[model samples]
Target: MYKTIIAVGLGGFIGSVLRYLVSRLTAGVDFASLPLGTLTVNVLGCFVLGLLTGLFERTGNLSPEFRLLLTTGLCGGFTTFSTFMGENFSMARNGQFMLMAAYLIISLALGFVLFFAGYAFSAKIRL
Candidate 1:
């Protein structure tokens, strides 16, 4: 457990640093444009994570540590949006259109609702 935790921490640190670098590099002289930097990283991260997942499945030999380190840590640190998109994309590509659509709808709707709920709850807390 400790090893997995440490691995995730290290991977997360590396991924976050890379994300910051990408953002900085892409933010040059752009104050009124789309967030291309974030989109770029998210898409790229999704592709890489997809590749890793496919590789693991094909090989059928991988440790939980790898998943924790790469998927939960690296991709998550890089951009959780990528992971969410990737999962939906995979389902759609595999002909699980209904599930994909449902997941997307529920995830976005519930995410927004829950986010607002948390914010309101926190604001009301008497601490």
Candidate 2:
């Protein structure tokens, strides 16, 4: 357990640093009102996670620790959007269309609502 945590923590640190650098590099880039830096990171993270998932599924030789370090730590720190997309992909692949749609709708709606709720709450505090 401790070893797993350490592996994830180290990977998270590396991934976060990389993310910051990427963001800085693309700070001024934008397309169609979207932040290109974030779009790049999220798409890259999703591709990496998908590639790793396919390889792992094929090989099944990697240790759980390494997997966690890459997926749950690195990809997670880079962008949780990858995880969300990956989950939806998996559900679709498994033919769970209804559940996938529900998850997609609920997550997006509730996430936006919670984000604004938090923002409004913070603004109200004004401290």
Candidate 3:
């Protein structure tokens, strides 16, 4: 039990740092269109989650701590669903309704695609 807590905390910390780095690098990379930083992390996190889930499902013997660390800790901290919502809200409030809507559609659509791709790829690269 104690180990699980440590695993989750450590994983969360790493994931959060990685997320911050990604955000920093993508900060000024504006294509003058979408929130690329958040989109990138969210999609990447989703892909990783999907791949791990696939591998876990295939093995069915993953440690509980590892599972929590990867999913609850890493993915949770890495993906910014709250940030995504906030971005949408901010864009809408600032009267960028169309951009907000487009961002939502593109993010959701691409996220799903990348996640599926990762999962499918995992099936082929079984551990």
Give the candidate number with the greatest lDDT: 3
Residue 87 error for model 2, in Å? 22
Question: What is the Å distance of residue 108 in model 1 from its true position?
Answer: 11
Model 1: worst 10 consecutive residues (lDDT sum):
118-127
Could you tell me the lDDT of residue 45 within candidate 3? 93
Give the per-residue lDDT of model 1 (tens digit) for 1-127. 9989988998798789888888888976453333446555665665556656555555546788877888778877887576567777787798988777766665656545544454444443343
Runs in model 2 lying further than 4 Å from the true structure: 80-127
Sliding window of 10 residues with minimal summed lDDT for model 3: 27-36
Q: What TM value does model 2 have?
A: 0.61
| Poorly placed runs, candidate 3 (over 4 Å) | none
Backbone collision tally, model 1: 0
Worst 10 residues of 2 by lDDT: 118-127
Residue-wise lDDT of candidate 2 within 4-120, one digit each (tens)? 999899888878888888889998875543345555566566656666665565566789999999888897788657656776788789898887786676566654554445434
Comparison by TM-score, 2 against 3, better one: 3
- What is the TM-score of candidate 1? 0.58
